[model samples]
Target: MFRNIVVGLSGGVDSAVAALLLKRKGFNVTAVFLRNWDTADETGKCLADEDYKDAEYISKKINIPLVEVNFVKEYWHEVFTYLLESYEGGYTPNPDIMCNKNIKFKKFYNFARENLKADAIATGHYARSSFGPYLEDYKPGAKVKLLHAVNQKKDQTFFLSQVSQESLQRCMFPLGEMMKTDVKKLAVEAGLGVIAQKPESMGICFIGTRTFQNFIPQYLENKPGNFINYETGEVVGQHQGIHCWTLGQGCRIAGSSEKLFVLRKDIKTNDIFVVPGTDHPALFSRILITSKPHWICEEPESLIDSWTVLNCEYRFQRNEKLCPCRVYKSSNNKLIIVSEKEKRAISPGQFVVLYLNDECLGSAPITHAGPSLHSLGEGEITSDVDDNDGLLRASTV
Candidate 1:
């Protein structure tokens, strides 16, 4: 029932379904396909050419105009460079987060509104938006509140947290209310062609099934380094380079009987350390130093430094345990997490997201990690406890 809208048609079922939903609701809709990467060459051999074709077909079937915007140069200048820098700095940065905040929503939104004259832009992301009776009712100056999808398992609010408040107001997520199964079923019911049964892309958002290392040689000058075990302080193996691996990665530790996961990487020593086992509870950490916290609400008028209870998820584990945490600042102006529980594997460069109950509060980029403790909350502690803690055990040095 709204006016003009633009849906980011990615040639995926979710996007196709989203566009269909808008049309069914009787809203004026157009499909905008962003050409982020070039796949016509050998470099794009692994790319999904079929998906693009399907997207074009779906737009035709829906009777909506489709627009193609080439963002390959932008992707290289903005996203690819950022990704390389994060990795070179020995951090596991989430490219999807930056991609959404910088390109898809920021640049794309501007083009769609200023050039296309669209009232709003939409995507098939698995996150929800709550629009009030009127725009002013949502927030005083803000337009929308992005929330986790009803399907918690598929919720992508984590990737969307970096988006600005203004961008969120003008955004729509049509498939946010629908479950994944329902989304696919709708695609089938709509008579979408070969794409209806296409297997979902599971690798990196942009480069599917391609070894990132293969692409890294283009940007990073990899230098092979010594791999060691922290406990023994002995050279266990040699790595292709510290730049080639990330924190908590367990594969390819030299000369180890126990399966080792990467605990830390030392830039000065050019060394990488590994710990045994993937389920080592020590790999998880309750306390982590976070930086660059962004609030979706209005910027706080004054500097209010206080501790508040917030929901936290380190990764996409289904049963993400809750830990009480207090957020404070360090002498050098970084957010430090002092926790009530001994969590594990706090990785530098990974996103430490905060939540208020089910709603997203904001997030911070983890810059540093603190030492692991033996005891937490009045329990008989042992070295095994440390092993189970997952923080020190999985901590990448």
Candidate 2:
């Protein structure tokens, strides 16, 4: 058990409850409010100030010491820059994943250990962590194992997959085994009514309520492009920018009775290819290639040399059921995942977290998606495109 713990309080009921629980458990508890974003929202109001006020109020109510630290520069450089660049390069990057890896767990954990002199850092993240065998030693209880939270609906293991194992060993998730409903009830019973009823934050932490289209243009130049029909090769509509759209996004194709979805984006031509209907064949892919993966503990022995078949969830949040898949390595050392069933919207830049039952094995960033071998009727898959595109335009053989 940890003797001293610092909880990253974000002016939310979850963090407040975590701090209270840590205090009740007799661990030295201190609440730290992280100021990772200093920009004002669309309404010209600084959201961080409001969050700090709530955090201060909660700390006073809970009778715990509160500290505020700024990580704005770190976040802007490490997380925001990558996010904008990924979109500019026609990929949908997950900033939350990067934020956890670079800021919350890495930067905040270091500060707590060095400055606060804390034994471990805690957060309201709904993911469980336990000790396991080290990756290199294979000695039992030598490493940390990241697992899914008990509250499956609120489980955040996917976003947390990128956290380093060393940081995870010193990290505590107080809400791991508690449901969101129970946390709210506990907060109210503990005389924290204001925070108990507060609504959960949505969208990116810094962007707040502003739309991505409005916020992105402020950072990168928008290049308008034609919206082409994938099947007929006809330009049916036009878009303000290809970066504004992502794979499987519903397009309001002017004059079309049926709803159209983005099937692919040709970066060289600056054209977005669309197909009619949400369940278009082009939207589903059976093959996905990923960049070098990072394992939480160790890569399973079954996946080391030969192709190993495993059950995985392509997008865990939307689709809960596991999809059977086989994992292999390419000559270039990238991972190749072949799903038995077609997966919808296997977008580049999103993460594909692998799991064995409840334990999170590791994760990789999706770099390419193509139609399954069975899905192709005649011609073989072609790679006749620039590598900068970051996605393969799936076509039938």
- Residue-by-residue lDDT tens digits, candidate 1, 112-195: 899898888889888877662112234445446667788887888888878888878878887667788898888888888466
User: What is the lDDT of every predicted structure here?
Assistant: 0.69, 0.80
TM-scores of the candidates are 0.85, 0.90
Once superposed on the true structure, which residue ranges of model 2 sit more than 4 Å away at CA?
Answer: 131-141, 306-321, 372-375, 378-397
Over 4 Å off, model 1? 39-48, 132-143, 279-282, 299-303, 306-324, 329-333, 339-341, 374-397
- Against the true structure, candidate 2 has what lDDT? 0.80
Clashing pairs in 2: 378-397, 379-397
